[model samples]
Every structure is written in structure tokens, then in C-alpha cells.
Target: MAGASSRGGGDVAAAALRRCTATAIHSGADPAWSSRLTRPRERDGMVVVYGDARRRLERRATDGAPAVLRRSTAEEEEETRKKVTGGNGEKGEREWRVNVPVVGGHAGITIVPLFSQAVPKANLADEDIKAPTKRTQDGGTKVVQAKAGKGSATLSMAYAGALFADACLKDLNGVPDVVECSFVQSSITELPFFASKVKLGKNGVEEVLELGPMSDFEKQGLESLILELKSSIEKGIKFGNQ
Candidate 1:
């Protein structure tokens, strides 16, 4: 499935979906952030998963979708981590998996990564976790800086968009247990729309998984983020209604 990042495309796309009864899976940063309106009546058919490609890579590692199949061993994960960040020869020095269960909205503070729950397990100090959390929050800015303010994170976002779209299509075509993190109208949190791991099927979002267990740091992060995420969702809803 092709993806576009044009403004108001969600409006046009949703209008088309209403007419043709077609489903949509979106990963545009703006559209996914504002999915309540982008896919108003889609029910389970509208899937929104947008943000860092790193996050998607992490999810794919654990979900056993393709490429690497079984979960990455600590050593392998460390190597992969070094490759992504250009870390200075830290492969054998440390071992950790990229198991970030990102949630909430797709913006700073709103984007909550559950490093505490990461598998193969991350034996990181609070400072280490804090650094990645902030990095995830400001990932877009780093891209924008690298581009010299010419364009946003088009390439990475597109890759992430296609990845999510492929997963949705696979689920629609009867692939079982197709799960991914997405922002959707949910009761999992107090907010009307939140991003979390969702099970996909022919019908769409078959299930919205809970946030499960979190470390004290993660819990604090979640609490601090809720207000901002709620405001973002409210803003999207207000704009959509207009």
C-alpha cells in the first residue's frame, strides 16, 4: 500500500472510505496523531501506527514477523543497536533488546516508550533509560536538523507507514496474530484515543492490549504524559469536528 503525507489527505481519504467502504491503515505523523477524525467510522478497519522507524524495528524483532524470525539474542541485539546509533564499538560491552512498547500520542512527552519491560531485558541504569526516552521524543527534530530544515522525516515515516500497512494487509488476508502498536479509540487509558499494541484481523483492530507492567520510571512517565496526550487528542477531535 502506498502512503502520502499531504495535509488534509486524511479528510479526503476518509471521505473516499465512506463512499467505497474501503479500509485504511495510516502512519503519517499528523494523520496518525489525529486518527480520531482521519478514520472516524472505520471502527476496527482504521489502523494508525506512526513514529520512529527504530520503534517499528524493535516491535518486528519481538513479533517474529519476518527478517530475523526468532527474538534477537542479547549480543545480536547489542550489535543491531550499535549499528542504528553509530555507537563506538559497544557490541560485546553491553547486551539489550530494542523492546520499546511505545504508546500515547506521537509527540514529545506523549510518546511513552516502555524500556523497563524490554525483553532479553535491558540492564540499564535510570540515566541510560532516560537518555533513550528523550531521544525517542526528539527523534523527529534530529531528522529535521540533519535535513537542514528542508524537509521532515519523510523517508523514515514512509518506511514505517509501509511497514504498518503491510502488517494490516497481511492480517486482512487471514494472517493470524498480526499485532502492532497503533493509536486508536481505546478504553485502555482514560483518553479517547491512544497508541498501544493492537491485534489486527480481517475486521480491523480485533483487540487493544493493555499497557501491562511498567517500572516506576515508566509509571511516572505515563502519568506525566497523559495530560499532554489528552490535550493533543482533544485538539485533533476539535479540528476534525470543524
Candidate 2:
């Protein structure tokens, strides 16, 4: 991957995104992969970005990698990811670790990372996709289940926390159109809600790229989602404004 393209860790992606703001910098090749996304940070030249994305994606499975945070110390991040989907299962039972990145600010339903567009794009319905997607979405639920009705979903959630953090890192490191179906400010609907495939760059959120055309089911889902999304945003905004 050397000689491809790279940048230093701190807000490198943001620096690249600022290029488009220039009054005279209007060519097309400007790091316009979707303006405003940030690149990954570098440390000892290890490239933590890839591992982050991989873990983020893996979090959906019952076994997600250890937790790594977007804005936390490295030691804390790794410690977190390992906590969940950990302990070799209960009673020292062997449990496979599958990392899954649940992007978007944490919130039930509000958080919407796209599993359909995952790297290879697993051909799965909501249920099949749900297995991972839902598991990730409800990573909390899994934790509660594993807790034996004790504490709460802590470890696994941390794993997802790290994966998402890493994905953002990778995108910023000149990762060539690093695409993650994250749930950020988007235009898939009129709601200003979450969708996927946002091109990460120098900024925290480079571009809110389209979700392409929706299938009939997807279209219906989008339609309904917008209504709910709009309502949610309006309520949040209105409440915040007040």
C-alpha cells in the first residue's frame, strides 16, 4: 500500500477536505470523495484503521473484537474491545469472536449502520442480516443475555465502539474511498436521518453519499423510516431549541 497515498494522524482527513472550500480550487479531482470526512490517525506506522474497520464489521457477530474508541486512549480502546465477546464464553466456554462496527452516535433505533453494504455485501434478509445486524443493533440485548441477569451489556458494546472508531481512522488515512455504511446525517430520505456508505475523509464526515436506488421493500422502508426519522429529528431539534 506504500506509494499509494497517506497522511499523518491528527485530522489529516479534515485538512484534505478543507481544500474544496478554496474559492479557486474547483477542479473535480479535489479530495471530493464526499466532503468533510476525516482520515485515520497514524501511530508507529501500524495503520490501526484497517483493524478498526474489520472489528467494526465483525461486531455484528456474537463475537465482536475488543472495544476501541474513536476518541480514547489506545490502551483503553483495545482493553474495551477485548472485554466483550470475550471470556471464551461463560464458564470458560469457547465462543467465537466476531467483530461488528455499530456506527452512529449510540442510540436505539437512532443508530443506523448499513449491514447490506458491508465490504462484500452479504446477501441477507433482515433476519439473516438481522443475525449480525440485529445482534449488533441489539448488542445490548446480547450482553444482557450473557450477563445472567447481572450487570448490563458492557463488553460487547465496547467492541463495537472500537470498530466504528477504527473505521473512521482508516477512512482518514488516505484509505482510498473508505466506505462504511454508517448512520450519520444523510439524504436517503427527507428526514435528515441515517443511511450508509458515507465516504470518510479528513473531516469527521466527508460525504453523505446516496444509498443509490431503493428496492420496492427498501423504498417502502425508506418511506416509513423518513416519517419516523423526520418526527424524531423534529422532536430532538425542537426540544433542543427549547
Worst 10 residues of 1 by lDDT: 71-80
| Clash count, one per candidate | 0, 37
lDDT string for model 1 (1-242, tens) is: 22223344555433333322222333334433323332334411222223232234334333322332211111011111111121111433232234456777665677777766655356665666776777767766566667664555555565555556667668757899997777788998788987778898877788999899887777788889888777666755654454
Encode model 2's per-residue lDDT on 136-203: one tens digit a residue. 34554445456554544444434544465566667556576765545455655555655455676755
- Cα RMSDs of all predictions? 11.7, 16.2
TM-score of each: 0.65, 0.45
Question: What's the lDDT for all of these models?
Answer: 0.53, 0.38
For residue 151, model 2's alpha carbon misses the true position, in angstroms, by 4.1
Residue 166, candidate 1: C-alpha displacement in angstroms:
1.1
